[model samples]
Target: MASNYLLALYHKTLRLPFGRQIFSRMFASKAPYFKTIKPLITELRPGYCELKFKKRKAVANHIGTVHAIALCNGLEMAMGAVAEASIPKHLRWIPKGMQVEYTAKADSDIRITAEIPAEAWNIGDIAVAVNGYKADGTQVITGFITIYVSAKPKR
Candidate 1:
């Protein structure tokens, strides 16, 4: 199978100074909504993606905590990265649904993560695990996003 472009780019660029930043910016541009959170992709591999974002007024709710929607956005960003990096070359994926739980208040910078087992990428619904952690490792959000994977449509 062919190597995934996103994964290959990540490996190639992460070594250069500021290359990770460039890659993150380009990645978020593909899904513009993710830019709203000022995401930083800290890790990207075949079956996992991790990112971080700082909390600020724009992302804070009325109580001065990071809003749930902001957490969801971060989770989605990580999930999209993982899906694109992990899927087989012959397959494609689209998000079908997301189910998440707000477990704790997001009081600091958040680390979001998405991971999938290699065998899970098949022609069916795949529930990818996602979570957001506070600076001190407290899990502020937990969830799974379902993605529909199938063979790429013929040209």
Candidate 2:
């Protein structure tokens, strides 16, 4: 089977000095909502994706911490990439819902992660585990996003 296009692009772009940023912006352009997080994608591959974003004013709350919504946006971004890279060639997916728990203050740059098991891909609600952590490794959020997966229609 052909390799996933998104995954391939990530690998190719990673060869450049600013490839991750280039790829991240390109990916966010596909769904503009994700652009708000200003993500720096650290890793992308089948079944997993990880990204980091700074706690800048745009993403900061009134108390000077990263906003919860920004974290959710990052989670969704990572989860979306995971689904696209992991699903079978003949299958497609859309996020049905998200459930996340905020645990600690995101006072610094945050790293977000999304992961799925090889066996979890199927024609149903597939839950991808996602998490957000501070630069120091303190987990600030943890939860999962549910994506509805189904067979693609024959063209």
Candidate 3:
């Protein structure tokens, strides 16, 4: 398979000083809503992605815990990164739906990781599992984002 341009760009940008910040800014320009969470992609590869973000007042809920929606946003971000790297360039993909469970409270910086099976490239819908954890290693949220992947229509 050919190398993914976005993944290549991420790898290249990650090596520069303050590259994470630059990458975040570029990503936010494409998806404005993702900027709200201030996510940093710590790892990205085919079938896997990991991201981290601080727990700030903006993302806090009524009781001062990370809001559920913020966690969901993080989950989606991770899933999108993995999908972009894993999917073949000849194919196209989009989020079909998401199912999530809030297992614990998030009161600290959060890390979200997502993964898909290596054989998931078969034409159809694929479910990528995403999990969020706090700094202390508690699993705070679990989710599966369904992505629809199909061969790009030929002109």
Candidate 4:
């Protein structure tokens, strides 16, 4: 199918240096949200990332709509990307806790964008927030993740 070809091209383009920007653009184009539920780093910049996903029946709850946890996964996806790209490579980051809230119904794919300012970042106990929105631009979920950043012992 044409969609398959496009996805393949997108994947290949993401391997380049400017791939981050390109990937971000492509993700925005498709608005793929469910496909990224497993927490994938499709695009990563200094302080931000674009997460993608696709809605599936399995992700539905008793209401037969996208589950709240599924939306939370997208939020965490954005937070994880920001955490990995923001932390110093010499240090390790571990999630400490998260506060989540569900505000609306999500019937379509969604994207979660997360970012943090450089001056606000700390090597010890970094707290970040990621907000998820539906394709129609409705806020579906919000989460605040606290991570503990520490130095690893030199081998």
Candidate 5:
């Protein structure tokens, strides 16, 4: 499954339009964030993805800490990258569900990491778990993302 998806990504890169190719390369340089927040993808691969998000005053709720939704944003960013890198181009995946556990206050930068199952993963429903922590190495949030993967129908 890992090899298959990597091959597909390589193939898809070749098929992308000239404009998209350039755009993708640029986007790959910087990870997109939620609204005003910009998360950076520090690491990404077929079976793993990691992103860093800094806490900002705007993202802070009345409690003066990172908003709960902002933590979820980091989780989604990590999981989305894992799905994008792990699933073949012929298939698509969506977040079916998520369970978050916030353990600490995120006052600084938060790093989120998601790992895909190793070995050959069969086509079907899958769940990816993402973990986020503050700069001090305290756990901040966790999420489980359910993804459905299936072959796209013929045109």
Candidate 6:
């Protein structure tokens, strides 16, 4: 298992004040869509990633609740972070599809967590489980993001 560059950068940048903001901004630069939700990576390690975000006007729906697409974006961001840390350097991955369920209304800040199973390391489609929870520990959404894993092409 090689060092995960994303995790390494997270550790290095987290030592300074406002580092999480800096990290999020840097990440948004690469994936501009993530900027809409203002996701902050709170934790990242092998097989796991956690991201937190607030329900702002930008992410609100017609009824003023957190929009479904916003939650999906947050889920994808967490899943991507975990996948990047979980896969070996020799392998490559891409999101295949996502199945999600909206269990409850999201009216406040929320946290999203994604985890990869140990069995998912074998070459194939891996289903990563992602869940969104509110401040009171209530689950708002549950999702499974399938990612295609394969060997990296030789340069």
Per-residue C-alpha lDDT of model 2 across residues 42-94, encoded as one tens digit per residue: 88888889999998999999999999999999999999888887888999998
lDDT of 1 by residue, 8-104 (tens): 8887787789988888999999999999899999998888999999999999999999999999999999999999998888899999999999999
* RMSD after Cα superposition, model 4: 8.2
Against the reference, the lDDT scores of all candidates come to 0.93, 0.92, 0.89, 0.67, 0.71, 0.89
Which parts of model 6 are misplaced by more than 4 Å? Answer: none
Model 4: how far is 25 from its true place, Å? 18
Using lDDT as the measure, name the better of candidate 1 and candidate 2: 1
Q: In model 1, which range of ten residues has the least summed lDDT? A: 1-10
lDDT of 5 by residue, 1-155 (tens): 23654334544554566633442344344454543456666666787877776788877889888888888877876787677777765777767888888888888888889988854245677879889898988888876877777787888
lDDT of 4 by residue, 1-96 (tens): 212333445457766887755655454344456344533445556577667666777777887667887877676657765665566556778778
Q: What ordering of candidates by lDDT runs from best to worst? A: 1, 2, 6, 3, 5, 4
RMSD after Cα superposition, model 1: 1.5
Quality of model 2 by C-alpha lDDT: 0.92
TM-score (all chains, Cα) for each model: 0.96, 0.96, 0.95, 0.71, 0.75, 0.95
Candidate 2: segments with Cα more than 4 A from true spot: none
Q: Report clashes for each candidate as comma-separated counts.
A: 0, 0, 0, 9, 0, 0
lDDT of 3: 0.89
Candidate 2, which ten residues in sequence have the lowest lDDT sum?
1-10
Tens-digit lDDT track of model 6 for 1-155: 23878878787888889998888778766778988999998888889989999988999999988999999999999998898877888899999999999999998898999999756787889999999998888899998999999999999
Q: Which whole-number lDDT from 0 to 100 does residue 10 have in model 1?
A: 84
Give candidate 3's error at residue 147 in angstroms.
0.7
Candidate 3: pairs in clash: none
Q: Model 1 residue 75 lDDT? A: 94
Clashing pairs in 4: 32-52, 32-53, 33-52, 33-53, 33-54, 34-53, 34-54, 35-53, 35-54
Displacement of the residue 41 alpha carbon in candidate 1, Å? 0.6
**Candidate with the larger lDDT of 4 and 6:** 6
lDDT of 1 at 98: 99
